[model samples]
Target: MPLHHYLIVAAALFCTGLAIAITKRHFIGILLGIELMLNAVNINLVAFSRHDPEKLSGQLFALFVIVVAAAEVTVALAIILRVYGRYNTVDPDEVNDLKK
Candidate 1:
């Protein structure tokens, strides 16, 4: 109902995402964390845009962010799949070198 409430939720989601990104060893897990952070950002943008009816810049930016995130996930998943095929592992720490 209030902006602060949204802000708090976004902050929590961002913090959780950051923690996940830092603690996860798997590439897919890290990607999930990044996606969570992006969603949190979108929440903030939408919440702010709700306050301003004259301009929809925040909402527009959020939409752009969604598109970017979608593209990012697509590219990332493709790369991850390739890496797994080549390395036979999804753990980033295990893949010290890109060369075979």
Candidate 2:
């Protein structure tokens, strides 16, 4: 496939993820959107790096992004679980009043 095709797909993914992250009120739904956006970024990184014959920077960056994303998910989920235990809910909007 061509580079433009990859870029287009990445753009679509980013847009969809952005919309989901903005519209979703659930913590898990927001996390899903963040993951989607990260994946889209990885696609773009790898696609652009494919043109370089001497360096693998793009792929390496994508790998780093994956690692970071994993760590972020771990920490975020832990926090969410803790909050759920205390509040019994995962809705972001409903959990705003933290003075309980």
* lDDT, model 2: 0.94
Per-residue lDDT of candidate 1, residues 63-99 (tens digit): 9999999999999999999999999999999899968
**Looking at model 1, how many pairs of residues clash?**
0
Worst 10-residue lDDT window, candidate 1: 46-55
Q: How far is candidate 1 from the true structure (C-alpha RMSD, Å)?
A: 0.7
Give candidate 2 misplaced runs (Cα > 4 Å): none
Instruction: Residues 16-95, candidate 2: write the lDDT tens digits.
Output: 99999999999999999999999999999999898675789999999999999999999999999999999999998888
TM-score of every prediction relative to native: 0.97, 0.96
Clashing pairs in 1: none
| TM accuracy, model 1 | 0.97
